[model samples]
Target: MTDGDARLTDICSGAAGGKMATIAEYYAGKNVLITGATGFMGKVLVEKLLRSCPEVKALYLLVRPKAGQSMQQRVSDMMTCKLFDRVREDNPDFHQKIIPISSELVQPGLAISPEDVEKLSGCINIVFHCAATIRFDEPLKHALQLNVIATQQLLSLAKQMHHLEAFIHISTAYANCNRKYIDEVIYPPPVEPKKLIDSLEWMDDGIVRDITPRLIGDRPNTYTYTKALAEFVVQQEQDKLNIGIIRPSIVGASWQEPFPGWIDNFNGPSGVFIAAGKGILRTMRANNDAVADLIPVDVVINLTLAAGWYTAVHRPKSALVYNCTTGGINPFHWGEIEHHVMSSFKRNPLEQAFRRPNANITSNYLINQYWILVSHKFPALIYDLFLRLSGQKPQMMRIFNRLHKAISLLEYFSSQDWEWNSENLSMLMSQLTPEDRKVGRPTKHAARLGQIFNILQLTYEPDC
Candidate 1:
């Protein structure tokens, strides 16, 4: 076989049940490059690396200028965030290790200057590809631009790194939602990426939007469709690169590491939790029996860092796919998440709730619609009328409209169950250092973790 087609060598010398090099030890003095360092997961990975692996040489962050702030200012502000508070307390000078590089993922060559490119290509030992548009409603063109095309570009840049040992690409467990059972392997892309890319290059945004539904086929959204394509794109270079892919399901709040119930945004379950807490959301459509598959952010981060070390040290024969999920191990369900969230909020209670904190989920469409009309629309209409009578701007109806749209997107995942084969998670966990393995157990945190999936119902977030 040619070099590109060479399969894995399976260096199973100590592949299982052996004391291996600690994650921190392996990261010592390594020059790591990270994209999306300002994002939720990116920030946690940086802090974990700094706190857990203090001897690491430096962290190069690829950042784009945003919202009237330079990349440096953005990184600086990111350091002051509450999420990094623990790292700050541990090492007051932790900010020194972060070096922000000016770059834009959507632009050509990632908008990196020749000087920055040279610096990264010469010294960077590993790369964490974490940046992507996670919005479920993103247009096909925009989603493909960031999720697939940008990934291909990053891999090209990884090819240029003279010392690069591992490339860890963060993907979602729902990328292959079209399939009911997901394995720890890259499935064939729905269509040839080159063909899709070339065909769309000449089309305008309007044309792409019209054909998106037909093109995406069984996938629920453009985000998943493009992400699945990205995995394939990454796999094409496995023969030449030491690569690891992390597929985490419904990533929720931190379970233990960094702290419990630490979530920054109102995306995902966080919104639903917050909305229900405020007594605004009283009903949702979800299967009472479907597995929630909530993986904590810290757990995902730990798995990611460990995967990086494994890919570099063992030099996996081909790309390794870690299905970082709770499906097989803990198997928490949507009904449980709903029960705990409502209980937590009812016990503590949100201040100034519109009504009382009472929410329920059902699987039947007619029953859900009846409750939505009674518990959601009617209340919102009355509240809006009250506001109008009081001379305040009428808004509750508009809020409900947005909430309906948001939950409509979420119900697809919540109302059904997908069997995610997470044997790879166990395989990788067995190889981790004993200390790392202790804090990263799924069953260990299940008690509290079952309640911390705060999916916001009404919080308007850009990434929603």
Candidate 2:
């Protein structure tokens, strides 16, 4: 057999669970490189690595200065954040193992200096690429630059790493949203990514905007389109590198780790939940019966770390795609989420509520639109009028408008369900030792784990 065939066979075989190293042992003394160490999921990943894999040699975080804070300051601030409190208590000197490397994903060579690149290429044993613009309204040009171009650049840097054992790329499960049944394999991209890049290079913003609808076809937005393209881009390097792609669906707050319902940002359903809890979002376009594939942030990180270990140890000939999802196993619906969120918020009560938390999800287009006017816009109008009469800025209406736009972008996902075959995910779990599998279990250590597996252990068993 050819070398490529041999590698493919090895990946298909996976690792023997009985003889595999423990999660902590696999990570010991490894120099790990990570991008997006400052993101919501990235922060959790870093914290878990430090607290769980205490003996890891070092963590090289790629960061760029943002919001007036230097990269060092941002890293320092991140280490001190409440999320890392458990890790801090466990090892106050955890920060010593974290080394910040300056780099920008949007620029060529990821904007890394020659010396920094040389340093990374020498000692880095594994790479976790987690950075990408998750905004729905992001311009096509900017999205492609960060998601596709930057990924290609990172893969190039990975090639130069003499000691690189695995390169794990974080992708969205929605990347293949056009298909109802998504198998654990890279689907053909809508357009040749390079061709699309070449075509868009010369087009003016107006022209590009005009044609985006046609280019994306059945997909919802530039975010999913670019993510799909990015996956394809990552696949180009699988022949030479041991790579793993993690595609998580609807990442939610920690279920049991640092704390239950510990979420910092208002992205995705977080915003919807927070707004609904605040009694502001009363209605949203979502299918009541469709599966809500909510996977906890901690679960994704655990699976990612496990994938990293597997990819490094087994050296799979083909990159294994793990469809990290919850609906397939433990199905939850938007209707249930709406019910639970409303119940929880009403019980606990947000500081101030616009109205009682009574949010509803509906699939009917006209019904959703009607509720948007009655439950959302009308209240905002009244609130804005009240503010205007009080000689204050009429901000409620503006907030609703932005909220409307965000909801519109997200409705496509919530309104329908997709079937993702996560057999690869199960295989990875089987490779883990019982102790390794229990690392993120809530029983022994709530600080190190959240009740992630308790949810994922139940499988959806898709035929695909």
Candidate 3:
């Protein structure tokens, strides 16, 4: 074995003998504060914490009432989801440890009551800020409101916590997609966040839309632009707080922990995979050799929890950034993904496929458009006609239009490549006890067999 592997093996063996405090022991009796507890990655983090760190004092979740459901009801519904099954089986009364506070991120003071603020300030030990709008099509104003302004608000609140140890912010690796090589550091944002927010607060929507192209420049969408700003904004708090930033690239299904092939969202590549599996998406633009850089959700959470511990215990002078990715180490390509997904779906076809699970990806814009017209538009037109003759609503063409728009927005990322330095990720892994490092490997043999059996049975992610 290589030197790195040997070192990891020694760490694991030492952990087996209880040589040091494990991650769970470090979190014991600590109160944790989490934002975006209702989100995809957020739910997984909560589940892992509850199961792995069972002795933690309590969990404070920031929530907002929506669709007539009270904050309490929403938290209750979340605890009962299949995602929390392992936690539930481990401890039926895990709900008792969850304390939900009603607060709106966009509102002044985060819409958090003074009493709730006081309560959080006294007892919370660690904070994980995971809430942000991940939609590519969101307007500039709303995206900034949630991604940048809310992050600033959270940092303000973190400053008041008497016992707060570490603050962990979740960000996307594509935040600086304008660059070819991204290091583990925050780059300068396109425009100052406060200036942009101040200038746009009074402008009409149409005017802002007109100027967005020039404002964002090379970044394809507002999502990445605002996220880049959020990173810069969070760094301003580095002097006062022990902070760590995790930037994940195209989070995919679970690798082994909880279960393999466990996915719950259609954002990023999930939508592309599902659309192709259902035979709805026939063509997309992507460089075949471009690294897919899809990190597993469970792995991201593991690194996130580990980072929180390291930041709190060691108290780094500056914020440490972990570019949680798979490209540099265990690189996988878009073409390989397309081939695997298509092959899996063909052997185990979707319930009602529009056509066979055959997808073609190309780097040429003209070739991709040509296939879109012939393979996508033509098939959609014929299917809609059949539906119309059968006395049903003609929806196939409309669906294809929406799909086209989504794919068009996504092509910019896939058509190019970006290099990310992950020395921080390796450094964090070196700190994990052998037991923590070995959590998911044993289950892989069983999970892989089950994964092939289930194939591409994806869970529906609510369209945000």
Candidate 4:
């Protein structure tokens, strides 16, 4: 076998045993405080921990009341989601261990009362910070407020936890989008996070919006810029806390735990896949060779949990960074993604699809615009014409236009490749037992397979 293959084999063997042992020791009586427990990744993290590490003492979730739902009600409803079905089946009373803390991260001191802070400081052993705004077009001030400032506040809180073993921060792999190669180590922030926060504090929304493009420079959106800043903020707490950062790229549906193809929101590539499958998206700008570094939620959570163990047990001198990605290790390109997505839709067509989910990813702007005019715009025009003739409203064109706008915003990510150095991820895998590796490997494989199957089955139906 090649050196890398031989190493993978050894690592897989070790993971099978070590993973369970680590879980047994680390979670036996430990309490974990998690933010963003309502988000996609955060939900999976909570589910996996409760299911696999049953002996974990307690889980304190930092939740904010949304709409009319109380924090406790939200947590209760969250437990009822299909994502936790497996966990529910495995441990029927898992919800009893979850403790919801009502606090808004964007507020000063995360809006936590001194009493709540004191209680957490004494009781919590680990903290998983997973909250952030993922909107590509989010306004600069709000993005920075939630992504960067909230992270700083959380770090300050983590430093107060007397029994804290590890503080794991979830970040996106696209944090450093300007670079082709992304390393596990944190890159110096473009501008100091604190300085940026202070400067933005005095500026109004319009002013911040006007300067965002110039400030971000080559990075595509505010999401990535603020994420990079958050990483730098987390690194600042390295001295007092056992900090670990997990950067996951394009999180998609669940792999194995709850069920395969269990996706809730229309964010990131999921939106693109769903829109295209429904025949709303017809043309997008993307390169065929660009690596679609889509990692499943479960895989990312698994790696995050593994990192938590390593950070707590080893307590490395520097903060541990895990580039939890599958692109380099199991490369898949956007072209293949397009092909599979199209095929999946064909087999299992969504209800009320606009037209057959036939689309192309192109690099040339003129060609893309041409296809948009001919294939997308023309079809909508003709369809609208027919609808008008039949005495119906012409809405198809408007819907296509909105989908076009959404796809345009996502094209940058689809047209590029990111090289993430995952040495720490490999190292963590090496520490797992052979059985644990066998279990975890299937989760990764199932996630990839599910994505491919969904893409092919949901995007390529004859009547889509």
Clashes of each: 13, 4, 1, 30
Runs with alpha carbons beyond 4 Å of true place in candidate 4: 1-21, 385-393, 438-448, 454-464
Q: What lDDT would candidate 3 get against the real structure?
A: 0.83
- lDDT tens digits by residue: candidate 1, 1-464: 32211110011112233566656767889999999888878887887888777889999999999989999998898887767777798789999999999999999999999999999999999999999999989999889989999999999999999999999999999999999999999999999998999999999999999999999999999999999999999999999999999998888767655555666677777778778889988999999899887877877898898889889989989999998877777777888788888877877787899889899999999999999999999988898989999999999989889989999989999999999887877787677544345445545365354345333221222231
Q: Please give, for residues 1-464, the per-residue lDDT of candidate 4 as tens digits.
A: 34323323332234334534455467778999999988877887888788667788999999999888899998998887766776788789998999999999889999998999999999999999999999889999999999999998898888888999999999988999899999999999999988898999999889998999999999999999999999999999899899999998887776544445566677778778778877877788999988888876766777788788878988999898888888877777888888888877888788898888887788788999998888788888999999999999999889887787788788889887889898888787667865455444444455468577445432211110
Question: lDDT at 321 for candidate 4?
Answer: 89
Candidate 4 — worst ten consecutive residues by lDDT sum? 455-464
TM-score of each: 0.93, 0.90, 0.93, 0.92
How well is each residue in 1-464 modelled by candidate 2, as lDDT tens digits? 44322322222232234566666778889999999998878888888788777889999999998878899998998887777877888898999999999988888889999999999999999999999999988889889999999999999999999999999999999999999999999998999998998999999999999998898898889999999999999999999899999999988777645545556577788778778878888888899899888777776788888899989999999989999887777677777767666766766777678888888888888988999899888988998999989999999888889888889988988999999998998888767654444332223233212333322221211110
Predicted structure 2: lDDT: 0.81
- The true-versus-predicted C-alpha distance at residue 226 of model 4, in Å, is 0.5
Model 1 — which ten-residue stretch has the worst lDDT?
A: 4-13
